[model samples]
Target: MNHFQTGRVSTNKNYFLMFLGRKGDSMIEQEIQGASVAWFKIAELIARREREKALGVCRLLAHSFPDRAYELQLEGDILWALEDTLAKDRYTQAAQLYEHNERWVEAIALYEHITTIYPIDYTALADLLFCYAMGNAYDLFTTLCNTLLHKTQTGMLSDTNYTTIMHQAQEKLQKYPTSQHTAWVNDFILWAATK
Candidate 1:
C-alpha cells in the first residue's frame, strides 16, 4: 500500500521521501542511510560505466521501496543505459516494448528519469504525464502539469510547444483510457482546454 492508504506521511529528511514502514525502526534507519549512500554510489557507478554494480543497487532500491518513485526511476535509467551499452540503438525499442506491453510503471519510471535530467523537454514531459495517468500516479502527474503550465504562462514554453504536448497527452488519454485515473486526466484536459 502507499502512504495515503497506510495513513502515514513520510518524515524522512531526504528530498526523496522513503517508504520503509514495514522494516521496523532500526532496519528502516539503516535502510534509509544505505539508500542515501547507495544513491551516490549508484551515480558514481553509472558515471564510470559500471553497469552491473549500478544495476544491482538500483534493483535493490526498487525492490525494497516499491513506492519510491526515485528508486524506480533510477532502475529504469540503469536498465536503459545497460541496454544501450550492450546494443548500439536498442533503447528506443526497449521503451516501445514497455509502452506496448502495458508496462506503464516502467515507462513512467523511464520518463520520470528523463524529465529530471531534461526538465524542459516537452516530449518527455508529455509522455511522463501520460504514463503517470495510466499508472494512477496522479500526484506526480499533477505536480508536473502545474510546473509545465507555469512555464507556459511565463513564456518559457512556447504556445505552439505547449499546445502540441497537451494535444498529444489528450490523444493518449483518449486512446487508452483507464477507469481509475482517467477522471483526473479529463479534469486536467478540461482545465487545459480552458487555458
Candidate 2:
C-alpha cells in the first residue's frame, strides 16, 4: 500500500511539472503576440505623423527588445522625424542613437551626408567629413575626397562640385586646425590645383 501511494505521488508530480511547462510556453507566446501588436501600433502612429506617440511606442519597443536592429532603426527614424517636424537639433540625437547601436560608420557618415537636392548642402558634406576625421577614420576621409575629385573630373558631379570639395576641405582644416589631418587636407587641395 505504501509503494502504491509513492507511485501515485510521483505520477502527480510529473503531471504538475508538465502543466507548468505548458503554462510557461503559452505565456511566452502571448508576450510575443503583445509585442507584435505594439509594433503595429507604432507603425500606424508614425504613418499618421503622430510623432510623439510614435516615439513613445518606439521607446517601449526598444526597451523590450534591446538587441533588435529593426527596433533600433525605428527609434532612429522617429528621432529623425521629430527633428524634421520640430525643426530641432536632430543630427546629434540621431548620431547618438547610431552610436548606441554600435553603427559607428553610419553615425559618422550622417555628419557629412549631403544631397545635391539642395544647392547649399555643401555645409552638410563638410560636417560629415569633420565627423569622420573626429572618428579617426583618416583613410576613409582621404578615399572620399579622392572619389569626389574623380567624380568632378568626370563631370559626374554638378557644376558646384569643385567649390563644394574645396569648401569641405577648408571646413575640415578649421575643425582640425593644427592636426595632421589639416595638413593632409591642405596637401590634397594643392595637389588638386596641380591636376
Candidate 3:
C-alpha cells in the first residue's frame, strides 16, 4: 500500500525500469535529472536510519539507473552501512564503471578505495596503475608501479593483468617524450618487453 508513483515509475520496479530502458533517448535524457534527485534522496533516507526504506530505494536506484554510475560510491556506502558483504564488490564494480565511462579521476579514487579495503585485490592494483598513468597522475602512477613490482616480486601478478598494465602504460608513452619520466617509461617498457 505504498504511495510513491510517477508518470513512468511505479511500485512494480522491474516494469518501471524496463519502460525507461526501452524509451526513446529524448525521454530518457529528460528523466535523468529526476532520477538523479531520487538518487540523492536515498542518502537522506540512510542518514535518517530508515534502513528498510533505504534498502528499497537502493534496489530501485540499481535497477532504474544501471548505467548512471554517479551514485555508486553512495551505493557502496549504504551497503557497507547495512553490514552487507557486497559492499566491496559494489565499490569494485563502481570503479569498473568509472573506467568504462572514462572518468579517470573517479575511477582512480574508487580503485584506491578498493585496494585499501581489499589489499590483496591484485586486479584493482593493476587497474589503478593504468588509470593513474592514463590520467596523467604521473607521480602516483610511477610510485604505485614501482611499489606493485617490488611487492609482487614472487610473480604473484597474473599474466593478463601484466599485459593490461603494459598496454595501458605503453599506450600513452609517446605523450611524455621530452619529459623527465621519458627514460623511466622506456626503461619500464623495455623491462616489460623482456619479461
List CA RMSD, all candidates. Answer: 10.0, 10.5, 12.1
Which parts of model 1 have CA positions greater than 4 angstroms off? 1-92, 177-183, 193-195
Q: Which pairs of residues collide in model 2? A: 111-128, 112-128
Q: Write the per-residue lDDT of candidate 2 for residues 114-189, one digit (tens) a residue.
A: 2332334455556555555656688877877787678778987764866676677577567545677676667777
Q: Worst ten-residue run, lDDT, model 1?
A: 85-94
- TM-score to native of every candidate shown: 0.51, 0.52, 0.54
Q: List the pairs of residues colliding in candidate 3.
A: none
Could you tell me the TM-score of candidate 2? 0.52
Q: lDDT (0-100) at residue 52 of candidate 1?
A: 80
The candidate maximizing TM-score is 3
> Could you give candidate 3's per-residue lDDT for residues 64-173 as a string of tens digits?
64565656676787877776778888788888888888799999998898888777776677678767765778889778766656645657765566556655555544
Q: In terms of TM-score, which candidate is stronger, 1 or 3?
A: 3
| Pick by TM-score: 2 or 3, better one | 3
Q: Return the candidate ranking by TM-score, descending.
A: 3, 2, 1
Give candidate 2 regions above 4 Å deviation: 1-40, 47-52, 56-76, 79-89, 96-106, 112-120, 158-161
